[model samples]
Target chain A: MATVAAPGTQAYARPALLDWLTTVDHKKLGILYLYFTMFFFAVGGILALLVRTQLAVADSSFVSNNAYNQIFTMHASAMLFLFIIPVWAGFGNYLVPLQIGAADMAFPRINALSFWLLPPAGILMFAGFLVEGGSANAGWTAYSPLAQQSGSGMDLWIISVIILGVSSTIGAANFMVTMFRMRAPGMTMFRMPIFCWTMLVTAVLQLLATPVLAAALTMLFIDRNFGGAFFDPNTGGNAILWQNIFWFYSHPAVYIMILPGMGIISEIIPVFSRKPLFGYKAFVFATMAIGGLGFSVWAHHMFTTGAVLLPFFSFMTFLIGVPTGVKIFNWLGTMWRGSITFTTPMLFGIGFVSMFLIGGINGMFSAVVPIDFAIHDTYFVVAHIHYVLFGGSVMAVFGGFYYWFPKIWGRKLNETLGKWHFGLMLIGFNLAFFPMHLLGLDGMPRRIATYSESGWEALNFASTVGSFLIGVSMIPFLIAVVAAFMRPKDQPDDPWEANTLEWGTTSPPPVYNFDELPEVRSERPLFDRRHPDLAGGGH
Target chain B: MAAIESSPRHEEGMSNGMLGFILFLASEVMFFGGLFAAYFIARADAQEWPPVNLLTEEQIAAGVQLEMHVGLPAIATAILITSSIVIQWAEFQIKKGNQAGLIWGLFITLAMGVIFLAMQMYDYAQLDFGAGDTIYGTTFYTLTGFHGAHVFGGAVFILIVLLRALGGQFSAQRHEAVRACSIYWHFVDVVWIALFTILYIVPE
Candidate 1:
């Protein structure tokens, strides 16, 4: 067990490794999630570096084709499954209960169970590299025919993913129940924090979508091991069936990955701008609308598959943009007429909006079926993915870390270092991904180990440099984190003058989050507490 | 501190336990829904039932036939449906403070559930096809296999409740576990009925 010295007193008995492994405290579990997901983030980042290094020069032999396939597949798998998807759970596990003023999550033991499932599942998924035929090389999508060609690693990937899906599905139900039943006295559904609303919708998506992924993986498992023919074309099975089921779950999964990041941005933007979230109810409805539309537009990914209904999926894909546009404008509107502070969190929040816009607009281009036909397997799609995930989701993740670091750890990270990290990341991000759009437009395909076209060399080289820059940008962020840990814990509770219930407690909150919460007459309970004279009548 | 205990955090409208169970059931529905979707796709894509042409020519010549017998499985379905009724009876008896009747009802239901499972295993052994046979065999076995596993889970749940009932752990107002078990038993029963109808009764 790790122990921390009590300040100006004897050493305190703190939770150690075994305590973390067995504890059901939402705070401890949340910390575990943060540590675990960030570790995977670093791992996935290294894999990304390996990929960029391989692609630094044309016809470079830094790694074999098979190795590149494994590298990129593992990269996407680690990022999507390990880092981005679960990181929200990390934040939600910590903040949702605090934000809603509950004692803990609805099912704290199940919450522990959910957290514990990840390590074993993640280890199993990655352990495939040590197996006979190299790790799963079917891309993260692991499309049929190609997916069936791999060895025991494919089996390991399928089983690990199914286990991970179960972990997420159970965790989703926990979040839903916690939000629905555990709000503080006057915290009505509409008055609930925007982050809570987003978590609720994200939970619903996880509950419905993850099991379908589990089922698809199950069928694939049987097909591989038991001679079942769910994806085999030679055995009276339809190969397109795999695409349909995979996308059905994965399209909603896209929301599961990003919506919580949007939630984090929503929280940070309102707090830093010194205002209430503009159109709170509209944001809630937009989130719900996005979750709903997310399910219908999955076939958009199937546009180039030739097995989907192009017109219907295209229209539905376009329709999702409406609610997303609502969120974008709502964010901008929040910052429109306010005392804005460009804290590191705010910069990342604003970065999410601008970058996600490009991602959304480019996604719309894919919905124009003819355009999709051209860019379907090209680096343009790769650029769009990173823009949405890295530019949007990764930025929000850092924003969330900066915003909540004080509250969670009870110390302030160096502001200057944070800004440096944010600037480097933003510049490095665009430099890395932006040129791929042009390279893809010029007909360079994705997932290949090397290309013969020397014409594409300069841009590829530039992209590699940017990728390494993004890698280097993490140093300042890591140093900032370490420096924050080294400092004494003296942050005041409401460092950002945050609006929600989480701010009503201590900097590092007590085991039970609050001694007594403020009166929640509105969504901005803390704000209302700060200015009681204007509480009931304020706009 | 006194006020904190009486706060609205503890005053939720539903029991967290029951709500959690219901939400868990919802995910189970989607899991089963995926298998059903696969079955529908395979059926829609097929020009024939059982898909015998999918087998190799030599194997076909050697009389490796495929068939689904509904008669015995129909009996098993009846038995499962009866167990669902008996479990509900057990819940009603406990609600009325008739612990003796509750015990008997659970005993009967548990017996019926075990018999249904035994009959299923026997039926699987008797079938002319396996999961490896064809798309038809694959879909059939996968759907029924998962449903059977759920039934086994529900039976274990019932056995735990039955032991608890015998130990006099539940009263009229304190039978949440018993009620949860019944809900799960009914769900498993309903799934089996759907599986029986789709896998056995439906014609090509």
Candidate 2:
């Protein structure tokens, strides 16, 4: 509180390690978020490899059913709760301030609180493994009756997730306020960077949707510990209520996971294509539309339960695709007839577009009533999700890393290594998830420990191999990251001839972010500054 | 680090902190909204809301009365409403540069908050139904219990504000913390009003 109102010049004189622990600077906190989430990403990836290995052969005894359930449940919980959801906050914390030309988030202490919340929550959730019954094995969805039956580990999972939700809810407020109030002079709502716009929308979704998850978690907790039956239909409660409330938050949570990645792609694609985002305003509005429509389509996930309005949810699910499709063409149009550069970020951005296209088209199949009934819990639904989440969001995360590496660290990740990482991850991602599509159609359900001779062995083996391939791909990314930090900070500001305000400052921007912000005559203030001849700037 | 200068700040309509606090309150609404949704869903789905037949044998034998008594909760509600006024008055005192008035107003408000919490506890002790007795008891305790927790939270907030006021921290132009406290206190009050109506006044 004292530092916020009056930051002493000497206050930064603390030892480096202590400085980070006590720091409220958005950039440092952002870096902390990245490190924390990426560690969980690795943990989740390892858990996933275990899942794939167990399923490699039919009726194989690699792991017991109990172990298998714990593995996959923790895998999804870690990936969704620890990695995908909050990783965007990492990117948002660092990039939002820089992109919008603010020195820090609107409330720096609150921002620190958000980042600090994640570590304890992540640890507490994973700590379930050490307990007698093992961590939350009722699946990440943790449907009631099943959720109620779990050991103390499930309670830990619930409490920890509620903590995480608190983190997210408050963090959402911070992002909203930062974006709303802290943009550089003349950077209107429409003039903000595409990434910031996406983050703004993501924050809104988080703010409105996350608390509902908290509520549902609270009810589940009460049902479990307090002998309440808010979700137990046998005891005057509805079982479907959990699904209703859970998906209400979780469905929008899917968007919360992906939208920022889209923002990253939007930022990367336009830059590498050497043009402004083809429809910047349209992209922003489309983001808002996706957010608006995200809430209405939660029932699509529940279609098989016979509890939802099938046609209405079906139609709303399809309607979400409209705005998404608009953004896809916007990307393509940006790349059309432009001086394109296939830098690592650009390559991953392109990968995101193509793979997300597949992801989108496949979701539409499930959006249809009959098709969903056929593939409800099958590998096909699993495949659809992996395509959207892994193929879509993870790709964007990597692209953002490579895209912003120089700006963040004042050194570029080696492109050659980056390309290897990109190619292997892409191939490995597709190889792993794509077979589930066929396996689903062939009747291989997801979340199975093993199965009898169902003739689905071949594709399952293939998917396992692909999962290992995805694991192997991480080596190059690691190497590239290590190699980059070993080098001195040598990159210049605006290294790729970028357009956003962040590029107007030094690479590895200073503590205050900017010393002399440019006169923002347009969205591309730095670009206008760079190309004085084109300073009449409409784009 | 203090070496890093803060960004230039300019916000209209509401201070950025106030706006941020308002947004925070909005999230709180959604949190309560989730509870309300569950309550309504539970109510709508039940053949009879209390579903007293579903109660355990022990609860039945223990004579867990499934009735909403309005007298005590109404008093608690009134206490909270009055505290909301007192907190606002404290905020208004700072606005008018009356530090003594602000301090007294905050002290009175905190006392009222404590009394409301005490009344809620008394209500809980007197109630025949336990939290586990039925869906009626479950939602009843869940909703009002959360509101009571919030009242405790607001009391702490007011306590802090009172201490800050005594320390001469706030005045006519600088009362962001007080203002934030005021907003939160009011939000908690408003949520209680809704909770009181839905849980106590409305017949199952």
Candidate 3:
């Protein structure tokens, strides 16, 4: 083994510290991925607080106009690239092999390579701040012309993003091959767990969409360094061309960020409701439909640029809402008239459903051409993305943490602390972001350092206070994690009476995952194993 | 100890490694796909075939033509195609358990790949225009340049596979590396052909 890391292995006679650094074990890598992404998660949150504090008052002098650009741009770059996108890779890494009854990922060494690529890329990206011009100030979108005008920091950001894209692309191939080939004998496609299914589709999206981003970044790099005019209008190149290629990848990137979150909530909803996923096949097809439609809606983000065919992109954008809506309804259907519990994971599952509904509706608001013209770059657009990403993706990430914490760590987070974390986050999240809708409608532009003494001060203040509250919500979560670590590894395999195969093993499975295998007669192999009489008959 | 009780390797299909390489190739196709889209967009926005209007008089007078000179590139493309065929033949030799054929085939393919890259370099030096001269030069160089990079990567990959083949590491039952290398080399060849057609054969 090239890596010396070992989490659940006793056979290897290496020190515990060295085991972690060089370990290629999927579970260890997964935990490393989580730790790395969450650190950036906190970093991004701090950046967000800085942004909100500056925007809290009109003519706020908290940050200079130039400093504000770096803060906000790095904020988004950290959250999307460092945190949300890779977090699913983290979850999928830990869970997919266990769920599929495979010993490890299809390519274990490549899995390590995928993970190790991240730290350097992240450092290279954030290292931009230490450079002369500060970090990439052109926003995460990094539209050219502006992208060209930034200093070496922009080049660093470009290279780092391309490296990150390479990580996910190969990581996507690993996931696809693992799920496709490694399932236990009886586990067919439909019988795979919902989380695994969602991952499969998300991997497909990452595989196809991420490379386009790499290509665009390369072009931008050329334009900056090699005097290429891929997007320079002075050289007969269309400025909109940058947006066209960027959104071609990024629009699908939206789904890449959220689909696994949807998958997590789907799992939590069904398990807590004590039922099968409502319309499981329909749900699967809906996820697939979302992946397919995700490709067509890239132009929607470009609608306001006026170079796009607004109707086609608008129609495609609204059409994507259909599959997403179907998934939402399926979650509801799983909960309808079934036994339901509001454990921390369930609370988040429910939060994901409700918040994503709002996200969907607000997203629709921007899909309409005239409405987009009004809200195009406004706080409303800001509100829409936060609702979808923070409300949608971040909510499910915590739910996943709570849901899988016992299984991964072999100990439980304090439930009350978990509840407090969830409640504060929900309130703080809504407080911080919900007001942006009103502020956006009132004509406050996003990415601006300050506003005049207009009537927007109050809402901005509320949003700022809310952003802090969201930050404060992390206190309980930190406590819960620290407290959980103080406990013994006493969790049984099926702590929550869960139905999937992951719960069939020890709380933390052994080095090679399963000691013995269970028969994969249904999607819920463990559930069926527990109740042979109800096998294949129970919902 | 197998450690695992149920046989995960019992599945009947393409090996996971092969499938993964194919998917990786899929991403490669999309990467090229994005570059191609940029090319067409650049072309669409331009006034003429080579977009010489955007070039300065000094650049034109200095003998920079956005229209590619195809003679040497044509020879390089043929060499690249021949390399692809030789690598596939190497795979067939391994499948027939003929190590000698496999070794000789890989050697020939490696030689062809080097020659092709050398010829491509010569062609680039012989060109009247550099990558920075205009959008035409930009798209031309970016597309072919990326393709050239892929060919370089493919050559390194083949060298590794060839080393393994020489090390007595492959047989009829186990030459996945050779197959993967062939698939990648073929992809690089196909991409070059597409580059040659669009940048050289197609008119404004």
RMSD of each: 3.5, 3.8, 3.5
Q: Write the per-residue lDDT of candidate 1 for residues B1-204, one digit (tens) a residue.
A: 534534353354458888989999999999999899999899898888778878888657756677877788989998999888988998999988899989999999999988998998998888877787778878888898899899889889989999999999987766879889999999998888888888777887
Report the lDDT tens digits of candidate 1 across residue range A409-478.
Answer: 9998888998999998889999999999999999999999999866999999889989989988899999
Q: lDDT of all the models against the reference? A: 0.89, 0.90, 0.90
The A-chain TM-scores of all the candidates are 0.97, 0.98, 0.98
* Interface RMSD score of candidate 3: 0.8
TM-scores, one per candidate: 0.96, 0.96, 0.96
Q: How close is candidate 3 to the true structure, as a TM-score?
A: 0.96
TM-score of chain B of 1: 0.91
Compose the digit string of candidate 3's lDDT tens values, residues B1-204. 322432444245578888999999999999999999999888787778788788888887888777677788888888989888888998999888899999999989989988988888888888888888878888888998899899889889989988999899998867789999999999999999888898888887
| DockQ per candidate, 2 decimals | 0.78, 0.69, 0.78
For candidate 2, write residues B1-204 as lDDT tens digits.
322432333225577888888998888899899889888988888787567767778777888788767898888888899989998998898888899999999999999999988888898899898888767778888998888888888889889888988999886767889989988999999998888887766776
- Between 1 and 3, whose lDDT is larger? 3
Model 1 residue A502 CA deviation in Å: 0.8
